[model samples]
Target: MANSLHDTYLTGLKNAHALEAQAIQLLSRQLERIENYPDHAMMIRTHLAESEAQQKRLEAILERHGTSHSMLKDFMTSLSGNLAALAHAPMQDEILKNTFANYAFEHFEIAAYRSLIALAEEAGDSQAIPLLRESLAEEEKTAEMIGAVIEKTTLEYARREAAGQTAGI
Candidate 1:
């Protein structure tokens, strides 16, 4: 049972690492394409830094466990992240779509971190709990930030569209 818990904790760490990588890639792509929404771009930039820190924290924990994150997992997840950003690029409602996606992704990260924290506790890794909690807090904060702007962003997009201006960021 101890070995199984440890293995599961390691797997959770690896997955969280990959998820952070994907988030960084996604934010970078979106940041590049954003032209109209300075506030949204700024939000993404902030979360990007947080994601980088989260990834590093995960790495430190993994290294302490005598393992490293899976390069293949990171690469594949990053590819998907890039593809997801690209998918919204051509839409007239690109900004709206990206906003929705970002909000959903933040919640997903929050859930992942919560599960990782539980696993760390079960595995008797007290050291990892704080790091996981920090990541979890960041995710929760980001989700709240996104939630706060959803209505304003959607309305802004609508206004721009009604004015026949370029609305997709």
Candidate 2:
């Protein structure tokens, strides 16, 4: 049972690592397209840095366990992230669409991290607990930040659209 739990913890760590890779791709793509929303861009930039750090932390945890992240998983997830961002690129309401998608993405990460934390606790991984919790807190904070601006973002886009301006960043 203990061995099974340890395996599960490692799998969770790998999934979290891949998730961070996807996040980096998504945030970088969004940052490049954000011309009208400096505030939103700044927020993405901040979280991008945090996501990179979180990836490194996950790598360290995996290393301590005598393994590393799945290269295939990382590659596939990153590709999907890029594709998801591309899907939003051509929309007239790109900013609004991205805002909604990002909020959902943040919540997804929050749920994943919470599950990872639980796995870590069950696996008796005291060392990994702190790192997992740190990532979890960051996810929660980012989610809250995104949630706070949803209405304002929608309104900004509407105002721009109504004024005959390019509002989709």
Candidate 3:
């Protein structure tokens, strides 16, 4: 017999976990692509190293849960390909795009880690807690990095805009 809505509990949490896995995979590759982009002054190499470790951890987590990596692989392929295609963008456009993309990706990662932490706690997956915490810390760092760039770039643009306004009027 098919299960009714009332018969299921914690269904959303499962979906959330699945989404987290996929988001992490996508973000890892996207960050890797940007790490190689010129003019990116952040410590992306170090982050990429950590990201590789984190990806292995995710693989372990999925394997432990008997889940396939197909979904995450698909998502990562699309996301990384899209980011790579922007490699030739003009400096200004690329900077803005990278900043915005990183910001959004960090938010997604933060949310993903938070969800994983909560789910692990609720499900008594104590071993997964540390993994989620480490991931959360990295996501926070990523957010800070993006904010630093956005602040500097936005200020410079704002100054130029103000200067142009004064010159016109």
Candidate 4:
């Protein structure tokens, strides 16, 4: 993930395509979670909407090079759907499985966007650089907001669970 675009400009473009293919899966999972989990729907609405747009953006990036419409896209989308469905599972984990999933996913997305942006800049793809940068901005904001939510809810959930256990005891 060092993103060394040293050799050819096409190397950078290929890297970006790979990132898009990856993102398409991640976003699909998030979207499905938004649809299935009524509890998180409102809270994650903004991010979901942005993610929808992000799907389009990523696809456009791939389509720019005619690489978006590939088998990789379908595979990634299926994988992401499976993963996203798990987001709404019972609050089994101490931190809330969904919250952990969201955080881990956002972090992954942030890295993907960062890589794409760096490669876009390095390759001198002026159009792509701005588009990638814009997506990166949204990804950053989404990650920051999700991080805040996780921080706020984590301790509260832990304390409540602890209190419930004590009462039961």
Candidate 5:
């Protein structure tokens, strides 16, 4: 039973790691095409860097537990994120779509980290708590930031539409 609980905790950490990698890919794709929304692009670029750091933290945690990330899962998730971003790239509502998607993704990450923290506590992995909490804070901050961006983007889009200008680049 102890071994099974530990295994579950490690699996959760691995999934979080893969999700962060997927976030990086998604942000990268959106950043490339967010020329019209400089603020939004900047926020995503910053979060991209944070996501990379969070991935490293997860790697360290997994290594401490004598496990490693699932490379296959990471690759598949990254590919899926890129494809999803690409699908919205050429659309007139790309900004709106991407902003909404980012907001949703951040919440997903927050939930994953929250679950990992709970799992770590159950497994008596005290050392993992601080790292998981730090990542959780970052995810929460990004989610809040994205929420603001969504509001700003919506207003800006409305204004542009009213002026007969394209709302997306």
Candidate 6:
């Protein structure tokens, strides 16, 4: 039973690692398109670096357990994130859409880290708790930042629309 619990915990870490990699790709694409919104672009760029560091931390955790991340899952998630970002590229409210998606994704990551922390505790993996907690805190902060900006982005979109600065459709 303990072995099974450890395996589950490892799986959770791998999933979180893959999701962070996907976030890197997602944020990179969004950053490229958010040139119109310098604040948003800078925040995304900063988070992209954070995501990379988080991935490294996850790799360290998995290495200590004698396992590694799932390459196939990472590839699939990265592709999906990139595609999702592109889907909003031509839309008039691309910034708003990206902000909403980013907020949701950050929350998803926070939940994953929280679950991983619980699993680590159950498995008596004291070494993993701090690492997981760090990532969880970062995810929560990013989610809060995105949430705080949503209203501003929405208002900016309205202003742009009124001024005929946005795309027609």
How much lDDT does candidate 4 score? 0.58
Q: Which pairs clash inside model 1?
A: none
Q: lDDT tens digits, residues 93-152, model 2?
A: 999889999999999999998998899888888898899899889999999999999999
lDDT of 6 by residue, 70-149 (tens): 99989999999899988988887788888888999999999899999999999998998998898888889889888988
Score candidate 6 by lDDT: 0.87
TM-score, model 3 to reference: 0.62
Query: Pick by lDDT: which candidate is best?
Result: 1
Residues 41-156, candidate 1: write the lDDT tens digits: 99999999999999999999999999999999999999999999999999999999999999999999999999999999888899999999998999999999999999999999
Backbone clashes under 3 angstroms, per model: 0, 0, 0, 0, 0, 0
Q: What TM-score against the true fold does each predicted structure earn?
A: 0.99, 0.98, 0.62, 0.66, 0.96, 0.96
Off by over 4 Å in 1: none
Q: By how many angstroms RMSD does model 4 differ from the true structure?
A: 5.7
Cα miss at 32, model 2 (Å)? 0.9
Q: What is the lDDT of residue 74 in candidate 6?
A: 96
Compared with the true structure, all predictions reach lDDT values of 0.95, 0.93, 0.56, 0.58, 0.90, 0.87
What digit string (tens of lDDT, one per residue) describes model 5 on residues 1-169? 9999988998899999989889999999988887777888789889999999999999999999888999998999999989989999788888898888888989999999999999999999999999999999999998998887677789998888788887874
In model 6, which regions exceed 4 Å deviation?
Answer: 167-169
lDDT of 1 at 16: 93
**What local lDDT score does residue 119 receive in model 6, on the 0 to 100 scale?**
96
Of candidates 3 and 2, the better by lDDT: 2
Q: Ten-residue segment with the worst summed lDDT in candidate 3?
A: 1-10
Q: What is the C-alpha RMSD of each candidate to the true structure, in Å?
A: 0.5, 0.6, 7.0, 5.7, 1.1, 1.6
Q: Specify the poorest-scoring 10-residue window by lDDT in model 2.
A: 120-129
Ranking by TM-score: 1, 2, 5, 6, 4, 3
